[model samples]
Target: MHLPSRPRVATRPVQLAPRPPQLVGRDETVAELRERLLGSDVRPAVVAVHGLGGVGKTSLTLEYAYRLQQEYDLVWQLPAAEPAVLSAAFARLAALMGLRELGADAADPVDQVHAALAARTDPWLLIFDNVPEAEALLPFLPPVGPGHVLVTSRSGRWPRDQGLELPVLDLVSAARLLLSSSGQDDEVAAADVVSELGALPLALEQAAAYMSETGLALSEYLDLLHHQRAELLAQGQAWGYRERVASTWQFAFERLARTSPQAIALLRLLSCYAHEAIPSHLLLSPLERWAPRELFRADVQRRRAYGRIPGPPARLLRDVHPSVLVMMRALPRDTLRINAALTALRRHSLIGPPVDGAVTVHRLVQAVTLDQLSRRVQRRWREVAAVLVEAVLPDDPGQKARWPRYARLLPHIRTVLGPTSPGMDKTARYLGASGDYRTARSLFQEIAAALAAALGPEEGATLTARHELALWTGEAGDPTAARDQYVALLPVYERVLGPRHPHTLTTRHNLAQWTGRAGDPVAARDQYAALIPIRRWVSGPEHPDTLTTQANLAQWTGQAGDAAAARDQYATLLPVRERVLGAGHPATVTTREQLAHWTARARP
Candidate 1:
């Protein structure tokens, strides 16, 4: 037989019938692929089915190949992994095609098969199975002829127009597969089983086999699967004719480790963060630290070249595959463990495409990863009370407002700082300053009692605690006790913050106000006069607080029967207020009103 020199191009399209052991759960995909194959307009004619391992890429191809058997004179299923094995299989296929001489040379069997398919006057279909690497089969691919080539592989990149990405089974399909395979009649239970296995066909098959072996109900099987993911992974068992999904994952893991370790580490660290979607910046931080010097330099230069500015650190990170995230989070606990996990995640494609300039992991994956990390990393909770006090206690009302949340955490805060640390006093003061007087009073009492037990009643903290107790007691409506606390706190404020300090001035002002409220304007006038110069020197004359102090001093002077001096002081303040604040401003207006009242009194 004279073989045709050029590859035959089929003018008539092949009509492929749907075949039995009817491939379940991929009706849409199979039909689509079939229509594409039969369509007259298709060029560079080929169809490739690709997915993660054991997601039925090969099975779908076989079912379709059998469907089209009658349309082609020759059908061949060539294993693409081993070249020699593939050549032998093709040699046998050529013998069946009546091209017996084509098998003689092992060195060029692919070219021989190519020629055989090209020469055939009748149309043919060929199936290439497990072709994980596309480059290996480029030479073996049949020449364009009255024939079709169908390829199954994990790799997505194939002849541009010929690729078909096969997704895993959806829940309904997975349930159907389980029920059919397990011979189980419970539809509800089957769905529950499918959901637990992530609705992946490979997982469903494994579950079905487990159920078959044990004669277990689908619900019971689901529970076993839920509780035994790691155990199942450890056992390395296969189900029906399918290899274990865990083993497939391990293969992918090994491949990734060999090809890209950085991606792997990035994947792991991302498992620690809470957000499902994380910014690319999270990966960039560690990459800046761990990447090879030249690669790091190139990465930076590439970003700079593109005018791509990096963003702030990520608040959250998530993963696509919860299992992969779990594996990442299972790393050993150490200072560098989270960092290592993040590196692993980036190496693998567990993290999805960047969205709105942020890298995010899925929430489900993040939850699983965190659980795994908790098992390995004993979390180190820091004592935040001291830092919180420092951040919060600077006479800033904004900072003081945050004290309630901190105060509620007092018991935990106490343990973090150790029971006897000075942090407890600061914590108490924070509560007191924030107006959480009841809690502050109780905490102060506890501190005083504790200090009295450890040191003595005269100790600084104990004395301060007594002072706080007196203030709270006064605030709780006992004037006598409040006076006693102010008396007690006065010396401590002077001793600790010093007499000229703003804190000391505040204590003195509090005592004066309490005395006035207790019906002694004479004593209040003396306290008010002492505070005026100190307030001016410390807070500045134009300060609202200093102006208020001066106003209070004038009122006290008037109350003590010195209306003339009080009138002069109020008159002096009116001009100062107008100069510092505009005439229409509230403070200036108030001062004008005060001066008018005092002047009217002076007329008497």
Candidate 2:
């Protein structure tokens, strides 16, 4: 089709769909997005507004384009679902720039568009609406220059830093959308509607349209939504919006079912989970168990069929079914089939964009899908989810390295393990490691009682848990309580394990360490001096426990204002530490740093 041309190199105003006149509750987001568009930072040339379907990724951007039309010299909007659509839009823009003659002679219109884009010096804006994949648009995108490109997509497949997940509105904003749409100030009904719809934009819009069209009150809308969610979602509105929230995803799920039943199957299992950041690993990959590898591997074949597709012991499985486990496995090579399934789901907006190293499925999407599945199936999937979580939780949550792992799994842990679970102590240890000492102390206190009941007052686990509680109580800030706990515990350890047993000495060491930390360096130095002989006698002079005591004595000697002695002690300890634990080891390095610190202090 030949096109009439305008003046050469002339610019056009921003083009986009008509935004809602009252875009309530997205002011902060719009401001942040605008800054991203205009800010001089290392962000990508193309910024993708991404999230679950109906989360307002497009609406938010469209509203920005409408409000800030005068800021740009040239603007263009395209339905960028297919590369062909982008090419066509480019041709139209080329025609607008009076390059019709050049475009006619050009073998590739896309190339012509790129040439035009390169020559342009004007501040322009390009909005690629409904981009299925950000990667596909790279070829045709204007080379990083005088223009900004905005993309709206359901996929989080774009670069993480370049994508913004436009969230649903807060209560005030959602209520405003509802009240304004219905043309009323019924604040109470608006609150009910927002609560019922879970602050989802599409659901709120549809519900408001229904209320306005049928002359229903907010209470009526809420009741109708509860009684007939599908009915409400299926109803069409006369406004610009054409699809209901449930209907949009219903079609998406139907489409996902066609090519990747695995995607739909995962959604069904995800619906049984807590929803939103429900550990992609829990659904996509298997964990390497430390303690119960055999128990974890008992149903390995069943796991492959349902949870993870298994490989040999040393091999890593990329994709796991939600019924087996769920967590994202960021394997560049694993994307062939399992990633294809995720891409298919992303195309439908069945899941939210991935964020903070995890992918989130919308809570509403999960709730709706669960409603579709049979109760029996839901029960079984729920059990699988619980089992997967329990199996994946680390053996030792007290370790600092395990904190991130613990945080990632805590929500799922809550689902599977309760206060009485044997694993509760592990959870408490994690809480302590995360710096929530009070909660950890309380948990330890509860578990200590439980342990006392289940396995005698002086049993190993019970005594250990009580000992940990004392340390954490000190950390939580009552040294007196910690002192009393150690004072009480020392007698038990001394009587039960003997005074020179490793555990009894450890209790004494802690009591003395607290004495130094609580402002009596002299007493602590004396305590350490006394404890050192016993530690050496009980556990030979070169034993790690004896070395630890010697190291503490040096630190306490310095705290008692004897820097020369401390430096000499650390200089001696450095050699033994290097021999025992390589020079590059963290503890060895720490001893070196301490020696340097004391050396500096001792010097004039």
Candidate 3:
């Protein structure tokens, strides 16, 4: 099709979609896009707005183009899903620039458009919408021009610092969209709908459009959504969109299923996790106990071959289907398989790329993915997820070194295991370590009550849960309550577990510590004095708990008005702490500092 020629290049030529009248939640993004594509200098600026499908990348780009089109002499929007269609689009631009005669004789019409746009002194903007790949568009970009090129793609293959990834709308913006699009004003119901829909723009728009069309109240829509989520997601008419939310994602899911079943499996497992950051490192840690030894060695060799350091161990395939185990074994290495799976999922926008070493799957994505699975398959994946999380949790939640690991997996643990599971004991400890003492107290209280009811009050787990509850009472600034609880529980521990048992000793230590913290340092010092010899004899002087008791004894002794005795005790304790815990360890450092303080007080 031949095109009619327009005036020469100085004349303004624009081919753009109409401006989006109300682009909620993207003002900042649009401003940043304008700044990135500003034609301030002679250098050509290319920025890629990358996001998952139906995230409104096209709407954002069109908004930027239409809002700022008047500042440029030329503006064009090119459809870039195919390289051939892109060339034809550029040829049309060439004809619009009055270069039809030149393009007819030229070997490549795309080159003619690029040269004309490149040579122009006036500013121009070219938007390459829905680019499938960065490399495919490289040849079509005008070299060293005053124009800005904006490309939008679902794939995040752009150079670092040149890509802007758009996430879903925030809660407020989503509510605004729901209400304004549907012409409804029920803020409460709007919040519920947006939460259910995961703040996804396309889903929100579809839901609002459905309500507007059907004369349904927001409350009715929400209730209907709960009962018929998949149907509602699929039923919306295309309100300026060719595909509804479900079909848009279904296409990606279908494509992913055909190309990367490993990614499909990974996504399914992720669906069973809470819709929060899933710690990628924990799942892929190289030190994972259940990783096949041969695969680990092969992965190490592979890393050496690539001149890269081996990373953490990948997750185990425990209690999973036999087919999954076979699939895992067929791969070269676990890490390689996982990385490939992540890449595939990212390419299709089915999962967000890793951020802060964690990946987040949208809640709606989780809902839809789980909804599509057979009940048996969903049950199996949920079981596999629980095993994966439990296997990665460190044995000691008290170790500060493992706090980040716990933090990353805590959400998933709470999701898969529920609040009262024995697994939550570690979560309660983690909460205490993180200074959330009150929350730890409440959690332990519930856990202790539940365990006592289920397993009998004298069961070991119930006693431990009660013990944690009392400990956090002191930590939460109620040392009197802590002291009283420990006072009541110590005899029970001694009678039930025997006096020399570690649990009884631990209870004794806490009782003494809280006695001092509750303002009776003399009594606390006496209690510690009585317990230290037994602790040393039973658990050894250098056991961490024993050292902890000794340290507390010195603190209480000083507080009980015996600075000289405290000085001598800390001096004696310092060397043991240094030798056993290391000189730079925080506990040893505290001992040294304490010895200096008490020595000064005693001398004066």
Candidate 4:
């Protein structure tokens, strides 16, 4: 049967275009924000841009703020900080707009900020940057009016309709941005760079900036980037930025360690999975180990004091902070520590609030997080291979008899073991020797060259593998190839086990059968004649193998048209078979029947 080719998985990272200088690739988002700001239809009091950090939320809001500047008599950009600092900043905004406050604490600063916006008849625009919490800012947000308020945040609680989610740039926009930033006029090279960088605006920007600083061509920069992405992302000093991508992550990592140390460890643990998405339950094991009973009790007490939970179940103990979730989503693949990393993702709800028994992490995030996993976390990757091998092994009679199920999971087994694993070689031999000859043949050939290099030309295992390879080749309809393989193995077996050894005898017997199939009956007769005396010597006349070899020689003699010789041989073996076993025994009955048939044929 012809097997279909396995599908190849695309390993390249997805690329998105860079935001334009004025506006990136979010035309629809900008349009939606504009309509809500200017349109008379139930004008929302607040317009928000909500997403993960570095997703261009600030850029989108800034672009919209500039666009609506003419419509509003006053436009103010507010920096989000503590509530007290925000109130003070609002007071300063009132002073800048030339408003006199009657009392400092007539009401809360939130109420005061709202009153100030309400007092304005002229249309106004307020751009609030870096609002971390929706609840804290809710009191400060003014009621809906002709004026517009635009806010940017990393929080998930912002109103969805009014919120603009900034996804990464598409390929075309990303390519253009790389070309423009690197000052490269060649479209072809720029496109190549963008594709290689996965079209993420941040990655593209870093690549472009790297090229600009080093004065290297796009292709040369890409080669460097391919070899040294982690190194390049670590170079914040060269770029004059407070943090390069790597450092920004490290800052987040440090914060997580301080705030929620368990979650940080969980992030490292999750880095082990290879799948695009992993079930959330995989995190539970590490968390259970990391957070002990006494410490968990203390955490429950703290949450209870804070009124965070009404009851203390194990689930309550597992709740991860929102900030940690953001960090897990943002983590680069190579740097993620799998066991800790996945646990962190579960805690953060980045992957799941696992319903039932399963949850799936985003493939891209999972990949990036896995890339970040440390060597210690890599033990889990090895465990995963062992898990797959066990899961796919034929465990029942039906499974052993049915070849398709075993065939289907073979690739998964191969993938789990990886190409270079020592387990792969052992698995190949075990399957081949265990009667899954077809699969064994392919696996043997695949690893043979490597094994040859490592174990040398005349190794015992290599010779055995070649013998099996030949046997399967004959089964697969290549008798000549099988005959050649048997010939190759014959000398090796004789040298290793001696000519009269049982294994060597078996090899000779197989070679004779291949000789007959290859249309050389004379060679087959010679082999059978040699095996008959050897088998008789090894086990005497009563041995089943000796009798079987005699019977085989008799049948070949009959086929070669020597009926009298064949009858004589059959008559000699008949008493040995009858004396060794009962009449109903399968071998005894079969030999008696063969004698009758040869006797009848001779008479005719």
Candidate 5:
């Protein structure tokens, strides 16, 4: 008898990152995301689900992805907590798709992943989980063609058209989550628990876990929740918030502190920033970090030397301002060490996934961490953040090219320095430079008033702010008002900064510019002709300001009905404009066009 050969069965690996168990009350969310992924729109689409941390953003997104698992050929989850982590995830994906050649070196895995994604004929889904900021997620996002991208974040700042906010669950669903495995037959009892936990799924899950682990019933859990809320909430280990949502993560924090003290220390510093996106380079950027340590240790040692000393038996401690400096010099600068700490933090979810090039901590988490710090330590943390942000701030807010960098630090600037802080002047200047004249004008006016009061009339920062306010005020459409301000400011500039000083010259230039803009072309032309000599002498004939003044003079000369003079003036300036600013420079090009137009008009 001939035995039949065994049939061959081909097996292929299917990729799907395991999602959390027991999703409740997110059927609508899952359905909505699914529809978006499978929509008729052929263009690439991104759907971001956002809300407070621990509101089940990740769970909701994961559940949605799982439901549509069969509809796509590929499914991948990437951590968005840091740029490196995101890159690593992409590198892994690239390798999986046999694009390892692009991933092997220190190349950006995103490009390879993008190419692979574009090449795929099948539909796919990529979830950027725990994004810290919208900016951070952009680099890793593949070109939206054949694949659907879903982002889970705590930031509601994602583009409005593509984002869905996840709110806390309703009573019935919240109660159901708690009751699902409680074996508790009473829906009313579960509702009570849900109500006590504020109908938050994360909190409910923690409550359920605590009950299950400790063999407590719903009534018993309710008793603990009321009487020993903090202690009960601290019982379970999890990654998420540390307050409101705190109960669910207290254990994880304690464990993190034990397993990675550096992680806890990093969190302590991070807790000082706004409870939103925090730039990673602010920590790992190789700044002169030990300065903060030296300052801290000196303060601490001084306090130790005199702040508290042994006294009479009745009073064991005495307070004094101890007058000596002690140095710890303990702030770490090693990139590897900092990275290790960040890794530990991510493992514990103390910090969210990175967006752009930074990470974020939940507001509640920040609250909890700050609550744990001594007031003195908290102050030091704030001081450290201030120094770093101030250093990174763009040098000149007047340059449009610097606005993007300035904008990145704006939130941190507001956090480190109050609304009335002198730092806001520069921020406002940058705002104006970026074309937000309305906001710039308002901020400048407010800051100028406050500064004038605080620093008195003659302070430099105050006058500078006032000058900016007036400039933006003009840009926002009141040249006459701006001209008046410049007239008033000129005397002060001359008195304080002296004749020919840059500030004095700037005020003069502004005065003349607005004089013409206010409909006095004749006066402007005469003023510019006079100003051009002074500008040429002070800043050189080839200087930008000198050329600018000459151009203005030429324009107003034409506007004043001297077309022949304007034509001759422009022709004379054309060679200088080309020599100094290049032949194709916009100003040079405009000058040539002006000369040609004037010559054509004068030909008749």
Candidate 6:
């Protein structure tokens, strides 16, 4: 009897692009890929790798294929960015598999290829590169059998547990890539280059390629990167990449512009901010709601008047430019629209997946996006960003409940409005409130100097900055320095703001507090005593500030060595504090504690 012969399976050539000439810093990922695809008990193990454009998804997939190709009887890579192109590639793949006759006989060549792979017992590997949608490849994927499937995409819509998101290269690997690709020996310059490029592998490679071709030193290349960013980013083509670094992102931007104009607008707005985590709540909230009315008034005032736009000028409302009016009216107010825009950007990997209610765009993405904008457009968005940030700040920065919000918005405020912005003073106060008094003091110092230089030493803004600097100095463990600073500032405050100004009175109060802190309790007591009647007269007897002054006077009097007087003073003030500030108020609680302590001391 004769046995039936099995059908002969042809050996097909692996069609992977050349392996990245050198794979740097992906040992762990490569290992994980091996375990996911080869170690699985499930047949035809499937995995998808996704990440930002230019983050090395393709390079990583290629490396994995090249490293382990020998384990498969057949390996093929197909570009899946477009349906028509992918379909044609499938036809070519059919021809390669010697399934041309079978495909020609069938209505769909892709279907024939899928069936052939399904029936085969020989191990196979198929890679789909640049897939824009996971469902687009449903028809092209071979069924479960003796094969494995790998996919790379910028989209993150792959099935859970089957997708791996690739991040940019680590700093060390990024520097090594730059040094090796450029054939340069400057480790320091290489490090700087990688940092500027956001440790993105494609950017590092393109930068290296440009340096290698031009023979420019790393430092020179870095200078060009800063001064001629758009030109430099558009210049170089890496060996294996069809598009330069800028083009890689430009394609995504163009796609977004076509599919979701709102997403493009959001990305431009984000470009105006520092490359830090942007809380999603900021975008979803109505722009008018986050941007206080005063911010627009200030903006319009600056545009109309030639000099410093001081305090909120209600008069500026009528003088507002038509353009400013349009911008205000155009402020984004639709939460659904904003959420959809965020989804669109995330779909293209233009922004990272939202973590803890915030998202981050890569620094390079920010730079390239800004470079593409007209100067006028850039300025408009920046103004919008600043206004939004300023509006979100709490009315009371020193409130413990509001400190977390301050922490979240501080980096954005500093970047959008600069260190000298009036909002920054609140941020400094927040830092001191949160107990980073040293940073608070240092930041206030910078603000004071900048304000003095820009607005003159005697400007109201400058005096306020100086006042904050002194207050934080006392809080930051330098009571003597704070005392001396207040001493210098009080006369200036009196001269410029007048002795009766609220600012002048506040300065007096801080001076007294710091003097007590600096070890002169008697002087502090006397100063408070003098300020009490004036505060009471200026701010009403039961006003919070007047009550604060009285409370401070009692504490300092006790410190000046009259415990009985302090006990009686607190006894008198405690009911007033409880009545005005509420029985549960922090000040009321403290007054009760102080009364009990001074009462006990009086007994001795």
Estimated TM-score per prediction? Answer: 0.49, 0.55, 0.71, 0.54, 0.55, 0.85
For candidate 4, lDDT tens digit of each residue in 1-604?
0011122222311111122364446678888887776764554357777654444566676666555556666666666636775676667655444354634545455555567667767777776776766777776677755567777765545555566555557878878777877789778877877665546555666666777777888877767656766566554232212334454345445656786564554454343443333333432433333323333444455434423344555666466333333333333322234445444443333343334434443333333444466544445543433332433344441334534444434444564554223335445545655566677677767655544565555665556556667777776577898898899889888998899888788888889878777777667777899888788788776777777777878877777677777888888888877788866789878878878878877885
Global lDDT of each candidate: 0.59, 0.71, 0.79, 0.58, 0.70, 0.81
lDDT by residue for model 5 over 277-338, one digit each (tens)?
88865544534444443433433343233212123422321221121111012333566766
lDDT of 6 by residue, 1-604 (tens): 0011122344656787776898899989989998888777777888999989888888888888878878888888888888987787778777767788534646577886788888888888988999898888887777667988889898877787688889999999889888999999999988988888999988888998888789899999999987888889988778678777777888889988898887887787777777789985664464635343556765555423422445346665655445544554453456667668788888888898878768899998888888887777677777778766766677687899998888887778778876666567778888888999899999988888887787789987778778888888888899999999999999998888789899899989999999999999999999999999999889899999999999999999999999999999999999999999999999999999999999999996
- The top-ranked prediction according to lDDT is 6
In candidate 3, the residue pairs with backbone N, CA or C atoms under 3 Å apart (3 or more residues apart, or in different chains) clash, namely 284-313, 285-312, 285-313, 286-312, 286-313, 287-313
Question: Candidate 5 clashing pairs?
Answer: 80-353, 80-354, 81-353, 81-354, 82-354, 136-355, 136-356, 242-246, 243-246
For residues 387-411, what per-residue lDDT tens digits would candidate 1 score against the true structure? 2222222333237565644544454
Better of 3 and 5 by TM-score: 3
Among these predictions, the greatest TM-score belongs to: 6
Over 4 Å off, model 2: 1-14, 41-44, 101-107, 184-189, 250-261, 280-359, 371-380, 386-604
lDDT for 352 (candidate 1) = 41
Count of clashes in candidate 4: 42
Arranged by TM-score, best first? 6, 3, 5, 2, 4, 1
The residue pairs in collision within model 6 are none
Q: How close to the true structure is residue 363 of candidate 2, measured as C-alpha lDDT?
A: 66
Candidate 2 lDDT by residue in tens digits, 140-180:
77665677788887766777668887777888888888888
lDDT of 2: 0.71
Candidate 1 error regions (>4 Å): 1-22, 40-44, 101-103, 185-192, 234-242, 267-282, 289-604
